[model samples]
Target chain A: MASLIPLTAPDDPRIDAYRVIKERDLVGRGGRFIVEGRTVLDVALSPRNRFTLESLLLAESRIEALAPLLAQAPADLPVYTASQAILDGITGFHIHRGLLGIGLRGAEPSMAELIASLPEEALVVVPLGITNHDNVGGIMRNAAAFGADAALFDFASCDPLYRKAIRVSVGGSLMVPFAREGSAEAILDRLAASGFTLIALSPSGASELSTLARPPRAALLLGAEGPGLAPHILARTLTTRIAMAGNFDSLNVATTSGIALHAMRRTQITPA
Target chain B: MASLIPLTAPDDPRIDAYRVIKERDLVGRGGRFIVEGRTVLDVALSPRNRFTLESLLLAESRIEALAPLLAQAPADLPVYTASQAILDGITGFHIHRGLLGIGLRGAEPSMAELIASLPEEALVVVPLGITNHDNVGGIMRNAAAFGADAALFDFASCDPLYRKAIRVSVGGSLMVPFAREGSAEAILDRLAASGFTLIALSPSGASELSTLARPPRAALLLGAEGPGLAPHILARTLTTRIAMAGNFDSLNVATTSGIALHAMRRTQITPA
Candidate 1:
């Protein structure tokens, strides 16, 4: 059985990994991401995923409740019990999820390898400047659902592996094979050379989404919520814009990706 | 000319509307929803929205930058100019967006009225238990892009007017005519009565999305991330699920909504 170390003080060295999570977010240096709450922890522990649990924090009163989940983790993963106050102090907020797990960063698939592995006729989503990790995660999750072979992030985009992103994605970020492509222009060029039907998403420009037919192998490229794709990239690719009903301007980046993927699926006559 | 109101303290009564903006998210009673950054403010000011500006907060140095936008607000809307410190104090954070607008909430469409108003051939998404207003907002934005006539939220969902949800949606929430329909079962029943194909989204069950052909007057139902549509609702509606390529269990709710709406549109196609 894995050991359950009881931490009495907020400053206990054994629980340092759980300390000041917010501050760590601010610094962008909290090695390994935090998965808070029980449901997220449950998803993280699913047999399909291969995550290494660095530690598990459980409220002393809830040890019995977490017994089944603890058993799922490998024997080496430690379970830590602490007072709610100490847990709160360490996290800088109330631990509403009542459980926490830290998962080590895992191996990332190479861009070339991921592409080479896909079926010859594939739908891929290349994300640009989508700095919000949740947005990236959601995009990947949707891409996965729609049968997209891969979800690629450009260098300017946020790390898809960020803890909250993975958790928000319900662990799909890990399940979907994603890699970081460098920039909008470079990726666009690479995609073009790759015989991809490069489609840039913009609210203001180009062919109406309803009228556009899907290409055999396509990349539905999306930009961040606001500035959208850089003008140069938009100029270089086939642009498809969703026709808004009345006054609405744009959907959230993630939502836009969902619609685009869905549209691509329809055009390709694939079940989404 | 609108008057420039200034206050130096975070506790000042003049700024009470902006107090505890973060904390007030729980009860959602007070605390002004601050839409920071210029891009968001730009969308809020579009002539087509229901929201109207009540006031503007501008840094002295930033006044010149906002002259054109400031000129667009009606003369009655208060334009408050203050030192950075005073604006920060009142706002409870640094004013990075350099522009702020206080908008008066507007009346929402009644659910019955909204339903009656839809064209016989249309795409409508009824979002349920989607307490994350941002996701709802994002969904609306996609709905608009995908040519859906409207988006309706079930009563249990979060207020579309919540600040973060609005901001995350890129102000799409305001542009889409969203009504708070209190009951999912009631609305689902009404859609069925109206001859609308009510498709409940779930991963594990129902018809594959691709097989559907030319469905007219449809409502794509979605729940929040994780819990999805309550099983009771799922049991009652026409079922359809997004097809997946890998082991990922689900898609992000907003993305799922987008893909579903797009897929449903295929069913909306008229044989040409």
Candidate 2:
């Protein structure tokens, strides 16, 4: 069992990474990201989790309930306990959920490295120009629910490891494998080289989603809500459309991913 | 054409409804709701819009770009223009989009009236215990995109007209017909009386959503993410589920609705 380390001061350098969470830029702190709340903490503390768990800072009152999960922490993991007031002062806003952790994002595999690591019948979510953290998180949640093997992000997309993104994803970001690599075309090229069918979701696609027969390995391309897939990207990839009623084809990109993934799963080809 | 009336003061009684919007309770003020941004404003200003358009408070700068849509506003509708600083002073936050309007919520139909008004062939969404505005908004968006005839919310559900909800829905809440009335059981009873097939979406459902045969008039039931449809509700309705991989079936209610609506649409039976 992991012992709790009491934190008497808000500015203790020992908990430096946990300080000023609200004002700090979300860019990883020397390759570390923050995980919030109990749900995601379970994922971070799980066996064989891809991301490295460095430490946890939690409200003291929550110790009893979280004791079970904390039992799984590594021997060297530091579990810092603080009063709710101390917790609020350390972080800029009220950490109402009161459970936080510092995690090592580690180095993501390169585009070619990611492709080489994929399983034969892998399903991947390829997001381009996704600026909103919620959209990426929702996509990861759907990816986890639909059994997507991995996700590959283009240059302009937001990091799935963003604090809010991980919280919104309900730890699906941690469960699924992902990497933010080169430009959109470069990532697509690697997927193509790996024999993956590239499906770009657009309103003016050539084939209806329900009727399309999906291949064993496929990459689903998603763009921001309004400016969808770039023209060059759409021209080369198989453009697919979800049949909608009337002129309203404006499904949120995240919701669109759920529908597309479900439809693709219907006719999913099994790998040899 | 809407004639712009310049308002120099933040506390002008004429713009009382738009005051301190951030601090105001979401409860409709004298049966009126607030609409933010130009997109939803368009829906409220339409010729046959059900909601009554009270007035508009624009940041003066936005007035020029919004001329076309403003031209369509009713002759008597007030179009008040103000400096961005004055707009911020009145609303208690930066009106970055610089467009806001007050719309009368009007009288919503009772459960029986809503049921009686359904088209011969209709697709309805029934959301229960949805406290989150984003989830409800996202569900309405999907409802509009997939041609759902109307949506019925149990008493526990939040109002779609909540400021953030309308924004999150991208104005879809204004486009779709919805009624927030009755308890879960009472609403389900009315739908059944109207010859609507009640399909409750649950992870452990009896039939896969893809394989289920939908009827001419169907009502899709959704619940909040964790405490999904109460067991009693599930026992009385035809429980259907979207197929998932492994054990993770925790799809967001809005995402679940999108997938279910898309699947039901595949074999949607039209009116006789």
Candidate 3:
């Protein structure tokens, strides 16, 4: 039987992982990420990821509701139950989902290992500081769906496992292979070295996507909203601008990512 | 001089245009839409769209902030000033943007008229359901940037002008030519009749996008987030698919639109 730790106070040392969530940058800086809501935690706890499982915190009344998942946990994973008020105070944010899990940054894969994992013709989503967590998650979800071998995050992007990002993705973040590599340019270089065409998405580029006679092994590069592909990156990439009808400026980064992947996969014009 | 209408109560008959937003079907049935936030309102007030400026509601304290925009309103438009309490009471949600405007829906031109308003081979975004208002807005923004001539929303889609949709779209909603039309089939028929090859986006279907030899006068068909283009609609037109990396399922609709539009325009690919 798994041991249940009981906490009566919000500030107890046992529940430190759930503290001051509003200060996520500080928390992220410490090299830890919070997996919120029961669904996200449940997926993370699955055997494939084993994920430290650091601790599970839930409202006392709901402990039984999560019994099946709890029982599946490795014996050493700690389970903590606390009052709603205590959980609420400790979380700072509303703990409506009534559950939380903290996981160490698991293992970091090398660039070559990440590249080797991708299939010969891979579509990779390289996100650059597209800070809206939902957008990040949505992009990752699309990346996984459209045959992206993996997702590579540059320095400016948000953490893939942020609670809201994970929720918006419908648990896709956990399922998709992702890494926080340092610079987008460097990642592009690595992809290019591995025979991937770095297709930079921008509004003011010269090539239309339809005319390409052969789809190159490609990496669709996207920048954050407002600040599109950094000039240096754009300069180094094979630029293709998305076609828009009359005066539209740009699609949100996440939406843009989905469209790019779909186009990258086309072979012939089949009449729908 | 613009007159100031003081509305201390939520049910004031003059502000009827801004009521019952939570229930969108009713609003759609009524043949109207909502525009919130100062920036969107400012753009809606532009002479180009010439939106029927019904009234303006400003938090009493924000009057000074809005003085310049007020001066630009048609002389007959009324401005309503209300206390923060009354403003919240009126919108049914917390009024964060501090200013709101009610405008009659812009006069929608007939399909032919809308088409004639643009150049031949213009880009357009055709949204189907796409329930997430933010995605709709994001798509419109992309449409604006990629030079799409207009944004056409299918019958089942959420109102593009809904407060959250417009706010999330970052004012792109107002800058683009947009209107909600009937079913996707009906719209495609109209487009085909006018010489457009409607390219319906799908995950599992014909043709890789990169291999297309020629660009067509086309309309990109996009569906909502999950269950993409219905089989019936997918069967009716030129089904164009993007070739993507293997593991990804699909791109965000807005992204798909942008990428497809970019590809269709052949704006990125250079002659080999």
How would you encode candidate 3's per-residue C-alpha lDDT over B1-272 as one tens digit per residue?
47678887978888776666556622433546566676566666665343466777788988788778777777788888888888788777766668776656656666556755766655677888888877777776666566666777777887667656766665676666776778777777777777766667776657755555433455778898678889888888667666654433445676676666666565432332
lDDT tens digits by residue: candidate 1, B1-272: 45566655556665555555546642333423555557667666667556676567778878778777666666677777778877777766767567766666555568888888888776788898888766765776676656677787788988766766666666666566677767999888778887787777777656777565546777788888777888899888778777665455666677777666656654547432
Q: Write the per-residue lDDT of candidate 2 for residues B186-232, one digit (tens) a residue.
A: 99888888899889998889998898888888999999988899999
> Candidate 3, fnat value?
0.76
lDDT of 1 at A96: 51
CA deviation > 4 Å runs, candidate 1: A1-16, A19-31, A85-96, A106-123, A184-197, A204-217, A265-272, B1-37, B89-96, B106-110, B113-122, B189-197, B210-216, B265-272
Give the DockQ-based CAPRI class for model 3. acceptable
Could you give candidate 2's per-residue lDDT for residues A238-257 as a string of tens digits? 89999887735678899999
- DockQ list for all candidates: 0.56, 0.68, 0.38
Ranking by DockQ: 2, 1, 3
What is the TM-score (0 to 1) of candidate 1? Answer: 0.81
Please report, in order, the local distance difference test score of every candidate based on alpha carbons.
Answer: 0.71, 0.84, 0.70
Candidate whose lDDT is highest:
2
| Lowest-sum lDDT 10-residue window in model 2 chain A | A20-29
